[model samples]
Target: MNTENAKPQQRFLPPPPGAEYPLMGSAVGGGSYNSHLVAGVLFIGLAAIGAIDWWLVAWIDGCLAIGLLLDRRTMNRKIALRAMPGQMLLYSQVALRAAVHMFPYYAFAFVLYLGMAPVVLPLNFAISSFVMLYGFYMLLRVYWLVHYLWVLNFRWEHAGRTFQTHQANLKTRRSAIQHVLWAFFLGNVGLVVRCSSQVITIAGFEYLRQSLNLDLTQHPTLNVHVMSIFWGTVVVWLATFWFMLQPTFLIYYRVHRTFHSCRPLYDSVHSIHHRGVLPTQLDSGTISPLEFALTEYNLPAGMLVPNWYWTLGQIILAFAGHLPSHDTNTWMKTGHHHLLHHRLFNVNFGLIAREDKRYGSFYCEPPQAASAPEPSGEAAPPARRRHAVAALAGEDD
Candidate 1:
């Protein structure tokens, strides 16, 4: 064979017909594939023979496993892989969405951890208690201000159709009262559980760790449990955005369907929320206590995870989603999905996923005008000037 004309021998196995070969480089091999393999084998040997802590060995192996998962270089390839322009653009969009969604949860978790971690036990308890109750008012105020600004800025471009005239109604006023009181009560209970977890981690971590016999390494000068609590909470939020959110959306789809289809439950509990024929920002918080508890299931995780900050982050994230969903101005991207649910009670239940379509409940058609039936029990109050606080509370003014 002429040397110039000799074809290079194929290095990688051909992919199955019609399958697109991944062009990205493997995260592992792009670094030092042999080096990782040697190190991993050495660590496993050390762990198996009791020369090293098993927990430490496991951690290193976990990191190596993640590296292998991320590496794309191992994919069948005949040439050096480079990301295509379209692929790069898609990755950038995914990065931006993850940052926008997860930043707030991580920020809240950090703040709660920094605030409570250093305070003395009883004082920390008091502070967290204050955060749980008083934090709602602050959150509501901030949401109201931000939403008002958003509506003002985007009203010209993205405003959605409104169902009812914006007015203060007696029924909404009464609903607002129950909303505040219910939040106050539930907040206290939730924070108590969260704070108790923090106290236990601070005072009894060693005992608890030994009792559970979990495979976690101890830090020389720090409480590993405390570290895990904060970092674990942060990691959960990160994972939620990067991997878990879509699946979680499926779960909520079932939850919403159940709440809506069960007439006894809806009439007794969930109806308080449906009362908002045209939900406004304030109506976001005007849900019955039981419903609020059901929706905010993450807060209850403190019992198992002993992560107070996780619970606090959950509170922040819940209100962040709820407030915007109720904004009939449709400022946020997904606002119309829930807003449609309020108008056409039989449809548009799940938040982000099109599960309603899959399950035969999807309905996106809106009437030409606000034709939602009026609340049956209370007479609609006349439009009237009201106090600023009353306006913030979601009462018609």
Candidate 2:
């Protein structure tokens, strides 16, 4: 059941020759055997993000994921199980593309960040909070787009087309206690990692409160040019990157042949999640009751910090906000890693593993939508429904 001939549904960019249908079936061993190195590296990144500073860790994560995904031209090369000199060169080129693509925007945001809070110090809280949340939505948008096109729609059973039917139900099968533990541990991890930055920031600014108290006329000296925009933009930027790929981590525990098959894609675990290609507000932390607590893992401290009495509680808020709305990858866009993990035994191993580059999947297939019309609409007979825009319509390909 080689799924590799399925053709590409929609590419973020033009794929290399064979990527169109790289995985078709359950071929256990071949030149296709996936490497676990990427998975190991990702987990290492996760542990670092959890163990050290979330801000720096998240920035590195964003640079790498965005670097990898946005650089679709070289995905086949860099993400491959075996790295050749040719692949290394391709990776360098892709990295250059990513720098060209993401840096200016990063700089603009960075420039604005320094000035944003300083000019609006009195209003920094309100502005920063909203910007951060909005930024998250954008990240998830990319997540949704990638997952929808590349990962979910290419299943061997469906074999190379998008599923139009709306999906429902995303229940998890683990015990109540397990769910509780998952939520509690993961949430605590997120809260501590993501929120600690704020605690540190506050510590840096601890003198502000005192300065204002000691001399009402001597307001804290906040550099309007450098630090202002950073106040709001940095948080938004980090939140977007940190959470956008989080589902990658959580989904790992549920799936993976190395672990137990506690969940499946077409079933409750991921079905409801894949219902929409364009995720909206409802999609935020929208998992089942058993998994609801997982949402709290990625929350930013800005929202709840003001309401809490202890500074540590504010820190906790920042940490809890790491999941849910925080994730940039939506079920529609970048959930391929999770979805593939279910439908096929190999490939798409969440954020941790991407065996797809090596072996392809059991259902390695993607083709023009079955409803694809000829370039000249006149060449094609009129159908009952208008053709849906392709997955790669706006993509680089």
- Full-model lDDT for every candidate: 0.40, 0.31
Best by TM-score: 1
CA shift of 46, model 1, Å: 50
Model 1 agreement with the true structure over 300-332: per-residue lDDT tens digits: 113223234544654554454445443334445
Residue 372 of model 2 has an lDDT of 34
Candidate 2 lDDT trough over 10 residues, lowest sum: 27-36
Report RMSD for candidate 1.
24.0
Would you estimate the TM-scores of all the predictions? 0.40, 0.26
Per-residue lDDT tens digits for candidate 2, residues 1-397, read 2323343222123334422222211211111001112322544676666744456445434433442343233244233333323322332332343334344444433333333334334443543432343244335534643553343335424412233222111111122112222222222222222333343333334344354452222344533334544456656655654443343243322222222121111122222232222222223232321222222222322322332233334322322332222132333323433333232222343333333343233223222221232322222212321122111111122
Clashes of each: 9, 64
**In model 1, which residue pairs have backbone atoms overlapping below 3 Å?**
25-72, 25-73, 26-71, 26-72, 26-73, 27-71, 167-396, 168-396, 168-397
